[model samples]
Target: MIGSPITPQGVIERKRGIGKVEVEVKNMQSDKDREEDMDRLSDLPDFVLLHIMKFMSMKHAVQTCVLSKRWKELWKRLTNLALHSSDFADLAHFSKFLSWVLSNRDSSISLHSLDLRRKGCIDHELLDMIMGYAVSHDVQQLAIEVNLNVKFGFKLHPSIFSCKSLTFLKLSIWAVPWMTELPSSLPLPALKSLHLEHVTLTAGEGDCAEPFSTCHVLNTLVLDRCNLHHGAKFLCICNSNLSSLTIGSTTQETPYKFVLSTPNLRSLSVMRDPIHQLSACDLSFLEQVNIDVEAYFNAHFQRTHLALISLLQVLADYVKTMILSSSTLKILNGLSTSGSMITQIPCFVQLKSLKLKMKSSSSISDEGVSRIVEYLLKKCPLAKVDVINCRE
Candidate 1:
């Protein structure tokens, strides 16, 4: 009987059982290897994990808590929390979640930055409370964006401005009117950068003072789509350390003037509505200047275009790089000496690089090119020219 069990079919069945055992062994080895790798990752230092977590969004980083017992509490130690809730369907749920996280933050937490943006309406009280918590923790950077159809006022808590560790702040609003005016003097002693978008500064009938008088350490400032009305004269009272500045215009019809005295400014960019005129007092230290002239069908007076040319002429002696676009090129081209009238090209003695942008490629005709070449030769003999079509 033992000799009879050595048939071909019996041998084949024995080999199939051996193959199944080998497959199970290989899978066990793979699972063991994976477990060891996970254990090594869990043993990584807290600081290394925190650095890795910084690259992930707050939601995804928090989800790592479910990875293992060691990771359960590590996400709470992250100092930089950025929560973007653009797809949130319920505003109340979002508000509650924010409140819970902020309230549960540890007292010893040294948060460096906090950014929260939601597409739906946000409760104003919750926003102020969150800002207050950040200030108390000495947050260095804060950014907040909200979307709502209601108009509400915001009061910059004194604690927020007084945080000595704060350096950067950005605020964006949608359809929300800031009913309260920011204090004339912000207490951000260490603040060096500020950005305000879609904000309105409502100065009273006689309030002509500067709004950022206390931001003395500011070196970079950007304002976009902001409305400055009520005879508000924006004056840089003491930005001696300022190196960069950008100002954009909104749809307001009122003509406003900005008085900047940044003696150490190295870069300046200005975009104004064609309807409103702009005049800069002194840009003597400017190394780079960009003047953008937006066309307006109703306000085609071209006074602002002319004023900008005159302003550039004043700064030509100091600027090393210059950029002109839209109506600005047209104005410069109009200074051609073709007619019977005498025309003089404003000379830029120090300009080394010049960039010109036109609305259409055809805008740079033969006459326009010749006039520009002649003007540049007269202004800066060693300058190089670069032409770009914005429409392209």
Candidate 2:
């Protein structure tokens, strides 16, 4: 009993005279603890709070208004607006919410970015409205991805291409639908990066024109699984300022050509299937190249083989870094075994790095691969080579 612990209340019962001071000290400690537990999030500056909400959906950001009076109108000043269809109960609910937010949000501040993703069917008109709003607000970056259950012929608002403030724009439409043919005039002077997925670029009746020719400052372009329809035999990408370019598979298995006017292109990638032909004026500045084209060794084998060789030869002069896919190597190996070995494999003059991507499914013998490797090594004596087996 002599070594007992003393509780705050127990001290009041044992020594009534000194209990007053102990009570005051205990009350002061409780107040300090309460002060530490007070809401510190509400004390953050408006810009800092808006940044924290940038990663949240527009619905969630708006819901934060109910937290306190300080947060009531903070969402209005958000620079980045992210809206997803799944955040609402239905399309109607999403549309109504979007309309209200666009109309009621503070318009004095320029939008930094606008990201809209829709899973199901989205009304093209609704997307157009959003694009119009983004352009008017001087949105610097705009990305819209729509994965539809059914095909949608979605065409962007015309104002988007004229927005001089936009620097980055990406429009991707899944479900194998084509966007209406790109308008012939694309005058995005400030746009530097553009990515289009599953879009179809059609020809103008009997003439051919460059869709991105007017984008003078555009430097990077990616066309993923974009097809050329309406009698368009080839895809023409004539952008002088382009430095990075990627051409994904087209819809045709026939030998479709790419008329590239990228003189200053430094990096290039062609995925999925081989482009039958590549026409370039001058690739003296080309430095990095990645060719990952696949084709069955059927009747089309000869064409595919020739196309790849032609591309390599075109790049052999100035390319410093090069990567060849497993399929491409397999095709080249077939040429060696069939007694059609190229008499003169183009010697890489500036070749510094050479990578050969091999697949286990490649039935080519080790000796056959070695012959090809030896041929490359002999041609490019100063190159560092790596043989990587990227098995499927």
Instruction: List model 2 lDDT by residue over 98-137, tens digit each.
Output: 9999998999999999999887777777777898999999
Model 1 lDDT-worst window of ten: 336-345
Quality of model 2 by C-alpha lDDT = 0.80
lDDT of 2 at 132: 94
Question: Which stretches of candidate 2 lie above 4 Å from their native place?
Answer: 1-39, 86-93, 147-154, 174-178, 253-255, 296-303, 341-345, 357-368, 388-392
**What tens digits encode model 1's per-residue C-alpha lDDT throughout 97-163?**
7776676656688889999898776776777788888988889999878654555555555577577
lDDT of each: 0.71, 0.80
The estimated TM-scores of all candidates read 0.84, 0.82
> Candidate 1, residue 332: CA error in Å?
4.5
